[model samples]
Target: MMQRCFSLLFGMLAWSAAIALEAPAESHPGARAFAAELARDPLAIEQGLSEAAILATLDQARYQQTIIDAISRPAESKAWKDYRPIFLTDKRINDGVAFYRAHADLLQRLEKEFGVPASIIVTIIGVETSYGRITGKYRVLDALTTLAFYYPARAPFFQGELKQLFLLHGTRFPYATTELMGSYAGAMGWGQFMPSSIAKFARDEDSDGKIDLWNSISDICASVANYFTAHGWQTGGPVAVRANVDKNARVITPGSLEPVYPLTQLEEWGYHLGSNPGGAKPDGQTPVTLLQLEGAEGTEFWIVFQNFYVISRYNRSPLYSMAVLQLSEAITRELSKPAQ
Candidate 1:
């Protein structure tokens, strides 16, 4: 059965590669405007493809309403209560445990080397693509090109990503832009790294001289750890803790995820530690932030520490960080139980 599955996978990959190579090299009329723009870059020329060819490939990408709609209503926009169940599911938690055990050695080594917890790394992969089961169905070229030229709000950012994608295609990864698949926003692989993130932090963990996040578990896990370490993740630190706040007291929550207040200041403002399993309370001088999530049950409060803020750096979403933390906790708890 495993042999048959492997053969089937190989066949699909070969088919995809063939399709990518057959893509037209001529520029589409719509893409001519961007062709000169992309050609101005020396790096684009270094890719060995003419500016027209690059833009022609991009021209095949159409403006997708699904992309616009997906970006407009991200999971982070939902309240904690609503968002929590989406990622912290029974299936995700169970599959996370299985994945952790399967990659125990790699996870342990990554933690020792990068100072990121194994559970946290596992949770990230689980949330991003359910351990590689659902990386995405959209072509990365289509996603980035559509967003770069059509999405008015984040066009500049997507345009930059589009450039980086071309650069990545020229260098580290040798594949057609249309051949690779990823999220609507061009985040790829199990870790859902943007093109810039892949260029900056992705690693070839197995030392095979190729970084394949789609199929290489070692690269995927290590790349995630590298990203956390780069973003200043503190080892052995609390991610967040439930906090009790006075109902009548006016609490000041920072508009951003960055930690702005010290623990002493938060305590003085009527925030007290509520439930912490790790049992390590930070010192008075430790930086913290109050995260309040509105739910069906009214409101929930959490005291987010440095690690929580670091997690937010990945996606800039408090809900996302919370999901990763809670999912990690759930996976750890499940792993501790005896086999059924």
Candidate 2:
């Protein structure tokens, strides 16, 4: 008990010292270095933004200590048993079904054009922003700048995103950089797209010549579908199946969700199919990855395929991917019911 109390006190002290050490965003050395890099960056040159323009924008990016606190303890850090319920709630599932019904025509078009399932697309939006009802409360500039200059863990990644923000502002986005809002990690829109994702994957689906993810459902949905299509989302492909593991099943620790083994090979190694969620037979040669999630029942095993991997590209957590798959499954089943 004494040791635990000491640890807690030490943690609080360390946190306080860290916060105290951080200079204001405007005067931070990291912020100045970031501005220096953006001034000479080729993308900034292409955008025709001068050094003054970049500084003018950077000057508005006030660091929020809360963003650092939020990113430090991400929802993905939770166990599968804990994380699943956050997204796969009864309300989220029901809302997904209703959202599907309301946007059936547009969702259908997205699925048809991109070869991605409408249910999957709907689940993405539901999980990301609760169907746009809670897009985020932080400004994109603040979030990105805070993480880029203040958060050292992912400083390089966020710095790149900070640079991309300018490119997006000058080209794809019609709004000012200061007007954009997103998650603490600087992902924008209903889908929570990072600046890089918006640059590469966002679509102008409504033909408005501006991809408005906030108000335009067509653009938001299509942009998500296009991301899937680009990442090799196979039409009619299997997502995941529960695994029946034997006592002799190899204790495999996969480095990533990338499918490296086939079902037949897994079966040879004492893992076989259990609940086939998609009801589609995967070819014995299909590459798959084994996942062990701490489900409500206990430690549950699953054999996930390329389609599952594709979903992981959006956010690398297998737990997140599983929640999305399960939520989409629930929404799909609900949508399939006959209207009373």
Clashes of 1: 0
Clashes of each: 0, 0
Residue 127 error for model 2, in Å?
Answer: 0.4
- Residue-level lDDT of model 2, residues 226-337, one tens digit each, is 9999999989989988888899788887889999997798899888888665667788999998998887789998899999999999999898899999999999888889
RMSD of each predicted structure = 9.4, 6.0
Estimated TM-score per prediction? 0.87, 0.91
lDDT, candidate 1, at 190: 97
Expressed as tens digits, the lDDT of each residue in 203-223 for candidate 1 is 989988878998889999999
Query: What lDDT does each candidate get?
Result: 0.85, 0.88
Worst 10 residues of 2 by lDDT: 19-28
Candidate 2 local accuracy as lDDT? 0.88
Candidate 2 Cα errors over 4 Å, as ranges: 1-24, 277-280
